[model samples]
Target: MKKLCLGLPKGSLQEATIDMMKKAGYTVIVNSRSYYPTIDDDEISVRLIRPQDMSRYIEKGIIDAGLTGADWVKEAESDVRVVVSLIYAKQQLTKVKWVLAVPETSAIHTVNDLQGKKIATELVNVTRRYLAERGIVADIEFSHGATEAKAPDLVDAIVELTETGNSLRANKLRIVETIMESSTLLIANHNAWEDEWKRTKIENLAMLFEGAIIAREKVGLKMNVPNGALDQVLKKLPALRKPTISSLSEGAGYAIETVLDETIARKITPELKRAGAEGIIEYPLNKVIL
Candidate 1:
């Protein structure tokens, strides 16, 4: 098998990224002081590296693919091709604000308030262009980590990525403005995509990752309904595709199943129940393929 190199980000995001890989069916067992992780897939080479430098690494064709935040790739201004967005353990929640935050009690009330102020952020390039476009000039502080702590320490405000905003709230800071929204991105070297074997390996990994991520946000919903209510149930139930329909051996009933987004669970479940669906069940899924 042709070997394809993958760069896994190390740090807080490492644990979740590795978990995602395992769930996607590649065994990756990490150990402290080990940059290379043993994997079930002997065909691929896995290398753990700092995400801060991954964008350029991938762009320079040093690695075939890597996991890093969209914010970092933009900040690095590298020419890496983003293969996919992996939301990790938290899918729906990860696609959220990269915000400008300040202490709740601070005088900064809006984006306009950042003018002529100091702002600490890890996404200096992204933050700089954003601020520059608005004709606002601020003393931008480069933070390697914990940018949220900047405000309470009298750093004026900060531009940082937030998934739930809980960290910002705990730090006594409030979101002042949304600088940009970001999500975890699968990026690969442009030249790597030119090699059929290397490109195919990375693409397969991305496809598997997407399937796993989609399955997490959704479930296979199944239920039984009397044959007399088939039409009604079909009319009432919300489905992304045509629901799988099969008649029971008795012929007076049918089993129906469909994959649906969990976001509508509250409304869909009740509506389905009212439509004569019995023995309703929802099962979490991984790596759903079409």
Candidate 2:
């Protein structure tokens, strides 16, 4: 069996990364505190490490590929080929953010207010670059973990990833400015592509992962509608293609199904129901392919 070295990010990216792998038909089983995990696929060798170190290992040709944030790739300046953007972690594929935040009750209310203030974060380079662009300077302090708690105590503000900002609010912090927005990127070494067999396998992995992301954004909507409303429903329904229309069991109407964005779901569902559709079902997708 061929081996494909894989770097899975530790910390915040670990859970989501592993989950994505499982959803993509690979199971990573860890029995100890070790960095290495047992993967179900014979083609993959999985190692868990901090995302900050991922690009270096890839750049050095130690790992064949990795599931790390795009921010880390840029911060570490690793020369690895990015094959796909995992749609987890930050929903947006690009232009992600790490924000500078301060306590809501504190005097610091905006980005300008953060000037000359002490800000703590793990992303020093990202913070520095963002602050440089805005022409505002701050005393950036690096924190390994618990950076949120240190804010307003050991520091006045913090630069961190904002996903729903629930944690920031729970820690009594409000975003003052966005530092850097990042998305998880799949990267492989330049040399990895040199091996004909390995490169083909890597590309296959990328295809499967990308399909999983597409699947998450969509759902398989199946319903039965009056044959009379078929044309009208087709006009109103937003699907990847013409809704799959099949004859109903009793020959009452047509059974239709399609792939659609989850965002427009709620609105379209009621319309389907109003259009004399029944057995309307929306299911979470695991994989989608064109």
Candidate 3:
């Protein structure tokens, strides 16, 4: 069987990626000591790679496609095809940032203050380029792990990736500058992207992934409304598309259904009830591919 080798980020993004795949209609199984994961799709083989290294692997065509942070692509300077931007992180459905931080008590309060200081980060090349653009001369050191803790003593300042500022605050670090903001990207190898089969497969997966992400923030609502109060109920609804309304049997009013943001669904449920909506049902959605 012809198979497309796929790389899934192993560290922070692993669990989230696996869950996303499940929601997108794929089952991915990973063993404790295995780098290769078993995905239900026989046409696609899965391997676990670090997000930082994902771009390089894709650039080399080691894997047909993979999911990783956009920052890593720029950091690696890898030539690859970005299939789609998946805006999600390990903790939340939002972009993550690489920021320049210093100890809260440090004298450095701005990027210029790092003129000749040493900095620590896993993203060495990107950090170097960022400082170079500002004409700031600083020593950029490569940190294997625990980059947030290398400041104040081992390094004068540090460049770290954060979803929230909680970790930085806990480490007593203050952000002086935001270097870059990145979201997860579904990327493909240049060569693989030119192949019809692989391209179609990658695009299908990207579509499904996007649908699952959108579904996470939305829900489906269905209710019955008296014909006399139809206008009121309709006014209370906020929908991605027009609210779906159908007349009931004989003289019964209408059965209305629509998809809307989860937050809006909650707030408007009471208003809908007051508007004469009956048998109201709010349900979870697996996918919303509009």
Tens digits of lDDT, candidate 2, 262-282: 888777898878877889999
lDDT of 1 by residue, 18-119 (tens): 777776888898878799988888788989988788898988888889998877888898998888887653434367668988888999897778889988
Estimated TM-score for each candidate: 0.89, 0.85, 0.98
lDDT of 3 by residue, 152-175 (tens): 889999999999999999999999
Alpha carbon lDDT at 207, candidate 2: 82
Q: Estimate the TM-score for candidate 3.
A: 0.98
Q: Which stretches of candidate 2 lie over 4 Å from their true place?
A: 90-96, 105-115, 133-137, 224-227, 246-253, 262-270, 278-282
- Residue pairs with backbone atoms closer than 3 Å in model 1 (clashes): none
The lDDT of model 1 is: 0.83
What are the C-alpha RMSDs, in order, of all predicted structures? 2.4, 3.1, 0.8
Q: Better model by lDDT, 1 or 2? A: 1
Question: Top model by lDDT, which number?
Answer: 3
| Model 2 lowest lDDT segment of ten | 87-96
Error of 3 at 71 (Å): 1.0
TM-score, model 2 to reference: 0.85
Output the better candidate (2/3) by TM-score: 3
